[model samples]
Target: MSPPMIIAGIVVWFTAGSLLSWHARKNLGEGMIEYFLADRKVGGFISAMTYSATTYSAFMMVGLVGLTYSSGIGSLGFEMTYLAATVILMVIFAPRYWAAGRIFRLVTPSELLARRYRSPMAGAVSAVLCLVMLVPYASVQLMGIGYLLEVLSGGAIPFTVGMLIAAGVSFVFSWWAGLRSVALTDALQAVVMLVASLLLLGFITLALFPGGLPEALGSRQDLLKVSWTFPMFLGLTLPWAFFAVTNPQVVQRLYIPSSVKNLRKMILGFSAFGFVYTVLCVVFGLAAAVKIPGLEKADNAMAMLLSSVPSPLALVVSLSITAAAVSTMNSIILTLSSMFGRDVVRTFLPDISERTELGICRLLIPVITVVCFFFARMQLGLIAVLSSMASGGLLMQLPTILGAFFWKKATAAGAVSSMIAGGLAVSFMYVQGLKPLGHWPPVWGILVSGTVFIAVSLATRPPIDTEDFFSSLEGYIRDSFGS
Candidate 1:
């Protein structure tokens, strides 16, 4: 595809997104909740779409596609494991998140910890942890856009320009109407992502492989069997399995549904969407392997396939990928900014006004986006693991979230210690490239964090309101659903 056509498609797509943002903003209300959570009134399908778009970013179409193309069907199992874990976790935790968010008027997942453990430091530290881990993950999105556009446009768009375009769109959508605009645009992006990928798959199966994919696979049928080593597969799957609870961006989505019914719909709807989308991506990867065999680099599989497809179809898929990348980036930036304002800044200045807090969060959006853009410019070798690594690093927070609901003995000190130790463990291994005794870094991180959390809790006293906290949540759950 020519640079002119690629640029034209992006402009048209952005224009449509901008119109959607404007429409969302017209009905936006005032206050922190309204801005960040859309007044908790987003419909089921929109919530599902936003959750899907945010969770499955350019990673699905680009990285996951390439992963499947190179590694075969193990990628499918790894992703399906994540989807199954997410649905199960959602069923257990979404109601608690919704109930707590409503009762406490919370803005960030870190804020939930602050209240649950009765320690601002715990929330602040978790917020810091999120900021530290998620930037690289978000940067990988920009990196995807930079590489995708730079290669597809034959160097006309340039890498930096691609990053700038993504950063700019994300900042605008997130800043314009907060969750309202983000959710609305996410619905649009999700539709584009699914439709474009379907078209890509249809073309590959019907046009490229008239005999069907399984037959075309031929000797490559080795891909049909699971080949990933247990250590390799477990290491990759653990972080993502806990992603719904651990990642602040998606965890925050649990608080957006208007009612328990809508929340259930959101989870069920996401599960269904996830199943189909996951299968499509894995199949696309397999198709790429059959059609573009013997590529030197596996990551280049998706790019190679795009180049061979019709220019119009390629442009559509490319824009969808850009949408996926931008949607994920904006959600991360927004959620991080909210965490900063609510958990980090307020930890220092407890008396800050709502207006001032909202102002600080707004200013930080561009700041975060620029930081991610710079990281994208670095072209780090960590892009592939960055997603899982970020989630892994974030696995530190899982103990705290679980302790919040299930353990009365869970202490603020425990939450803080586990998060800090676990976060450090994950980060140290990732940065130094250490696996430590044949186990993944996250495996070590989780073990260390869980140990610290339990030991420290036994050593320290629970929050003074431990009993009341449990009663309140239990009461809400029982009363709201009559269980």
Candidate 2:
């Protein structure tokens, strides 16, 4: 595609997203309720799309492509294992979390923690970590969009300018409609990304390799199989499985379901879509390896392959990548705003009116946008870098959440210990990776954190407040014996 055409296509897509966002904002209220949970009125299809879009972002296209380029077919095993984690989460936690969120009118994941654990400090800590961690992840998405624009526009758009544009669009939508705008835009982005991936795959396969995808696969037999050991699988999937339950952004999706039944529908639909989408991307990655050899970086693999392809296809793929970036960034902005506005601000200043808090949320979007733009300029690795920081913290939350729903022994002290220990471990590993330390951070963090959580819960006497905490989750089991 011509540079002008590619730029024009991107502009058109952003315009459409902005229009949808405006409509969502106009229809939804402007208070914290609208800003955070879309007033808890999201339906099944929209919720499913939003969840999928947020979960699979530029990371899928840019980051995973990079992984494939570096690891060959071995990366697909990691991806499949990652998808399996999502499956486990949906089957085990989504319905219960959705039901409990609705029943209690929970606005944020921290609020659930606060209520369940009967500890405001626990809520504050969780919310703060969520906001802090999410900012970088959000910035990474913004960075991805900037890079895509820079590539597709053929130097017409600088990375910084692309970051500005993407960040501005996300801020406007998130500022205006909040969660409602994000969900609606996410649904649109999901369709565009999935279709674009399929189209690009078809075009690349037919035009470049006439031997068929099977032939391409046959040549890289070793690359097509799962080469990692069970230990490696556990390392990757164990923490990732907790993402749906523990990721504040993901947990926020559960809060907006129109009803518990709708959430169930959304989970089922999203699981199927996630499975198919992940497989397609991995297939695209493998095909790209065969077609475009000797790629420099894993992050640039897909982009390089797309650019090497026919122009029109490249333009379409670039637009889809941009959409993915924006969708995830928008959610992050909304989530960050929620964390700061509701969790931090309100925690410190309980007297602040809800209306004022909403205003602060609107203001925080631009602040986060600028911060993220700075990081985008740093040109860091997108997926792997960000995931390593979060995988441990999210995994910690998984035990407490799952235990709350099913296990009777989970204590607030245990939950808090687990979070602190797990978060520190993840951060420690991240720091080590940055330094000249040895190989990949052993999956010991997960094992160590889980052990600490169970031991702490069992060893420490339940605080006087523990009773209230147990009382909070009663609604989750109410359905079994008639509330």
Which RMSD values do the candidates have, in order?
1.2, 3.0
lDDT of 2 by residue, 1-483 (tens): 466787688778878888998889678866777678888888999999999888888878877777765666666777777777777777666666666676667677887777676666667878877866777778777877877787777788888888888888888767767888889889998999889888887786778778888887787776666676666566665666567777887888877877766777788878877887777777777877787777666677787787678887777788788888888888877887777777778878989888998888888888887887787677767544764666555666666666566555666787788777877777777765632223234365656667887898897654465555445546564663244
- Per-candidate clashes come to 0, 3
Evaluated at residue 441, the lDDT of candidate 1 is: 94
TM-score of each: 0.98, 0.91
Pairs with backbone N, CA or C atoms under 3 Å apart (clashes), candidate 2: 1-311, 66-298, 66-299
Candidate 2 segments whose C-alpha is farther than 4 A from its true place: 229-232, 379-387, 434-442, 459-483
Q: Highest lDDT: which candidate?
A: 1
For candidate 1, what is the total of clashing residue pairs? 0
CA lDDT of each prediction against the hidden true structure: 0.91, 0.75
Q: Which lDDT tens digits does candidate 1 get at residues 1-483?
A: 899999899999999999999999999988889999999998899999999999999988878888898888999989999999999999899989999999899989999999999999999999999998899989989988998999998899999999999999999999999999999999999999999988998898889889888888886988898888888898999989999999999989988998878888899889988999999989888988888889988878888998889999999999999999999999999999999999999999999999999999989999999999888888867755565578898988888888999999999999999999998888788878898777799899999999999999999999899888888888998998677
Alpha carbon deviation, residue 320, candidate 1 (Å) = 0.9
